[model samples]
Target: GTPDAEEPTVTAWGLEGSSLRPGQPSPALEDWEEASEWTSWFNVDHPGGDGDFESLAAIRFYYGPARVCPRPLALEARTTDWALPSDVGERVHLNPTRVFWCLNREQPRGRSCSNYHVRFRCPLEATWGSWGPWGPCSGSCGPGRRLRRRRCPSPAGDACPGRPSEAQKCVRPRCPGCGPNTCGCPDHILLGSVVTPSGHPLPGARVSLRDWPGTVATSDAHGTFRMPGVCASSRANVSAQMDGFSAGMAQAQANSSMSAVATVVLNKLEKPYLVKHPESRVREAGQNVTFCCKASGTPMPKKYSWFHNGTLLDRRTHRYGAHLELHGLRPDQAGTYHCKAWNDAGAVRSGTARLTVLAPGQPACDPRPQEHLIKLPDDCGQPGRGPTYLDVGLCPDTLCPSPAGSSPRCGDAGSRCCSVSRLESRKVHCSGYTLPVKIVAECGCQKCLPLRGLIRGRVVAADSSEPLRFARILLGREPIGFTSYQGDFTLEVAPSTQRLVMTFVDPSGQFVDTVRVLPFDPRGAGVYHEVKAMRKKAPIILDARQSNTISLGEMGEEAPLAAGIIPPGAFRSADGQPYTGAVEAQV
Candidate 1:
């Protein structure tokens, strides 16, 4: 054959060329040609006996004079084995009548020779495989689909008999309430509708409940949705959301059947600001006080904090509504108070307010008076000075010493002011000096009188200032009189050359004190001479007259002589009534 010539037509015959089979020839090749000189390709009719042609053995084709034919070309026929072309893709249709021609050119003993033959085998039967494990259900709660799959053996069976994977309805157990076993769950229903502001139904809105978080219902064309099998008497939250609207919520308690409806609307955002600021106040000490702060905003304030003097107060201690309350208020708690209100937009501070705590007992008063006025008169000498004769400065005998080289007074330092008759110490006051000093008989004074006169006086216990009621009084060796309930006693003695002794015994028969009145009183009228007594257990004398202040309730700081000096019809009471008689006289 010429180079690149088309393949020749092929015909098949029975053994020994006995007879030509019907349609034994294949379609003639048109543009196809041999790939190379040593190889060629051709199609065969059936070479096996059956018309189905299960196998092929040999291929014989008449060729032109060979340029290099093998020396011993074998004529034996067997199945031909060819290297399948890599470029031939999978699942391709193979021609039953085609044959592979593989030729080899080799020289043995200096002769180039080649041998070839064609062969065929019966197509292997396809083996089917067992089914695989079932796949997961396509749906969780309803009738759904599952699939199982298998595959025919690779390379040997290129085609499968049927579908590789088969799908069927999943065999799931009945649901608690919605399925065949309705008694497994409570028979409850949830029904609701979503709507616009105008009450028109809004379709395709999503409604969900917290109790069934994983489940949701979509509104139908009528904006109505229904869910069954919810637990009875349980609480749940229902919410609705859609595009171009804010989410709306409604609380639902599941019963035999629950019906909840909600409408959603959104508004523009706003910032928080104060509406009413807190006010200041003054309260009496130990009283309770309260303050309030109110505000306005789009979303209400979520929290509040109270402040005292610009410091944040503990939230747990006060009540809400921005209310700051203080109980048992005291002077120490007086300070500036304010409140802070907070919301999603921001926080705002209120105007500062003040809290003043007034003191107890006294009417709110000012500080003490500064200007001096003529002091009020009293039996205690002067109102401001206190209640005793020594405070009024009545000691006339003790005078200031004369200038150097001048005459000296009776109570002067070197003058004989004290005699043996006036033996005890005495306090001497000088003209130019403010303080006085004690002097004894050892200090000489030219003229010092003896303390010789009658003694009559009231007696009182110095520490308590209470009267030593019914006490025994003694003069020398004789008992004079017992002190009355008023702690008063009187005694008289002949002018004594020796110092006179005065003694007292308490009503309880307790020995009180003994004192020489001669040293205390020079003229000794003893009218203003009040005597003090001491307990014998500790026999120390304490002068009751040394105390400067005495308390008189309604007559506070008023002189006892003022009661007698009032003119007729000139008196007035505290309420400004005219000419009042004495209280006992009026009664």
Candidate 2:
């Protein structure tokens, strides 16, 4: 069979130049040449005999130019040859320029041959022919390495591929970081990547991050937040809530380093409501009063109504506003008032207020008068001029009729009849009445009236017959006059009368004696005298000069004059002088 095409193979090898400086490592090589045949000592026909390699030497050989070398050589190969081929070369020569070596051996004719018939194969191995300052090397190296390439340093200044240093991978935060107990951002905000429980980014959700002692922050649209100048030692707590979403919370530690992201979720909640009334009580008699109803609910009250006395009042009065104003009050309006507030959920009523009203003026009679009677003075003994008895009577008018069957009569006596008479005489029956009578005597030509009388007399003491000074002489019930130094008294009578009774009374109101008299005398210029009878125990008046002249006309008895009494200015018996004897008296 023709030679099978060489199986595809790859090899890695390195070569050093001869001119390389001391302590300098060589670079890795890129290319190589393939060997056709080789001979090995163990497979030789003579043991340990030098064989001729003329066929290998006479074969066409591709070679590279020689150059100065630095360190050593290394080669790595892979082949598809199943059994060793017989046409391989015995020895190989390395070339610096081409990065490959040629194999050579001696032939049987004791001369170099270009070809060999037996297969001789050897396993590939790297070769190092030189040494560097640190160690032997076969390829180029990275910066900061020893010429021998024994040890390499990492960017972090440690052994290559070891643990990183603090300057290499350790990172801290410029601002406050989040933690389990505090919000990483200022004003309780969440920072960095965050998600809800359902793994959706919460946009426009009010997320709050809080630190201890009431510091808080909010999250932005990116679900990231930061807090400036926050306490690094405080714990971070994050929360989020939105409409139609469940509320959620998360916690983190606020260390100087970066914090982990927190997740939040929100749930639904209920709202509270209230119904209130402003007034407490109402009065009877309905008044135009106002009622205020205040309602607070998640959804506000939609309707309001007022009730009075268990009946619904006019709905228009409640202005669909805060307060209800009622105009025009009435008595029927008095009742308990209350308000009701209603919404979609339900209705509520306020407490009742009681109301009241009042009523308006109403008529009445006069008082009666009492009856009384009074007596008039006895001195009023005249026919028409003297006072009359007071006939007390009850009349609507003071000018009403009297008891004497006359107009303007006494008010008390009504129509009763009465009578009056002379002093000390029997009372005569008359159609009208007179008051009690008072008697008086007149001394001059004028006849004496009972109350309006003028009487003249000389008053003397009964025992000594001497004129009394300042002696009081009373006529009837009234004191008429007083006695002068001459013991004389002149008094006017109240009424006109003929037969009179007189009494001598002293200042002490003592009565000496009562003498009756007629004022007119029929005799001519002869004084008539009347005397009181003297008692035996009283002194006898024997001296005629001491005797007082008492007029006999004032006497009460109807008696004849004494025998020698004469009338003044009349012929007495046949003599020319007036008569000194008793004259013929006319009846």
Candidate 3:
């Protein structure tokens, strides 16, 4: 068949093929000759298209040929419809159906070049088309190409993501907000910030401390504050607020930090409340005593007033937990005491406590009596032969009663008589008795003779010039005489031719020796016979004719007088005759 001399008409059409099944072919022009060679081209209208067949079918019509030629070549041209497998496409399908043309070409003639162009269209609605034109194609011969477009869905799920699984809704821990609150800081810390009621933060809230006797601290900008070295177990009230926000309060724990946060809400400032401590027991006198009154309130106590028996006490006393101490208490200071705790908001009084005191007992006293005696001896020369015994007594003056009756007495006579003549309440006195005298028979002898004259003198204290008293005066072979309290004494002896010694003992027991008396001649007679010289060592002896006013100064340095001797001219025999040569001595 000759090639179609007349200009050939080419018409293109699109066919819809079921993806599930195949359909029969139809013949539209019997008299026309089918083209032996045709080329297939792909059109991609959209870059990103839905995977539905509407986009795949829209380009089918542009793949068909319109008219046939008079000469048929050995090449075959046919259209086949087949469903593309769902899994065979990429994320998106560019072309659902594929078309191809096999053709024969003659060798090159003297110099002729043939060129043909094919067009393609989508079969579905305009909105349904390939993503865009297929990629670059080869020249001349039919080009077969596979096109695919990726499908990317809008990011799935909600825009904002749900919270993480590990997240939790937790409320912050808080402190018990209140002043003088018993809940205090733990062992080694102070009160930090107090959080809001809803766990919000409040900064710069003042937190006054009420450590009983004193107020210690306030909150700072971070709602954190501290009182250094304050006693633990102290109570506190915490409140916080800003200018525009309502105030709130919470009883917060003290000593809370980052690891131990305290949530404290501050309430609006209000009138303070007061709590009173119980009454204390009475204390003993002379003991250190402490009385405590524990109280609590808002705004913290301003001052602690102490009282004893309704009188105010100095508030400077050392205190603990509202306690007032009385150092070294005395019995006179015992009484009822009370205390009042006050702040700007309010005040409270504690119960009364009574204190009793006792006095110490008195000391004991014991009594006893004492006594002594002074007595004169009966014989001056022989103290051992004097009164053997003397009476003594002691009477009570202040402590005890006096003994009844006179004090017992004793003497040389061996008599049990009450020698004390006068018996006063605190004094006693007694007199010594002498032996009785006895008469003797007369002897056959001449009548007795009288002794010669005697001499005497007085002795006195050399230093005091006072007369010596109770002094012993002795003459040889004669009885000893005692000087009177005035120091006067006397001795008698017969005139004889014997040496005489006169001795005088002063009250101080000193011996004074007089000059020796020489024998006197009875026949010799003189008005004043100075027979013996008064010695400086003895009492002064004056002549019998001289007055007895003999002074110690009159005695000169002469030998002591001997006993039983007489002064001259001071004696005569008992008979009228003066013819005595010797005479027996007499005392």
Q: Which candidate ranks first by lDDT, i.e. highest?
A: 1
Give model 3's clash tally.
67
Stretches of candidate 1 off by over 4 Å are: 1-175, 178-207, 214-237, 240-247, 251-262, 265-270, 319-321, 361-587
lDDT by residue (130-196, candidate 1, tens digit) is 9999999875554467899997885643586688999875534435553322112445666666776
Predictions in order: lDDT = 0.47, 0.37, 0.37
TM for every model, in the order presented, reads 0.25, 0.17, 0.19
Query: What's model 3's TM-score?
Result: 0.19
Winner by TM-score between candidate 3 and candidate 1: 1
Kindly give the stretch of ten consecutive residues in candidate 3 with the minimal lDDT sum: 409-418
For model 3, the superposed segments whose C-alpha errors exceed 4 Å read: 1-264, 268-280, 299-303, 317-321, 361-587
Q: 134-166, model 3: which lDDT tens digit per residue?
A: 333222222123343422222332232232222
Error of 1 at 201 (Å): 11
* lDDT per residue as tens, model 2, 16-97: 2333322233322322132111222111121123422212221211110111112113221111232211122223222222
Candidate 1's TM-score reads 0.25
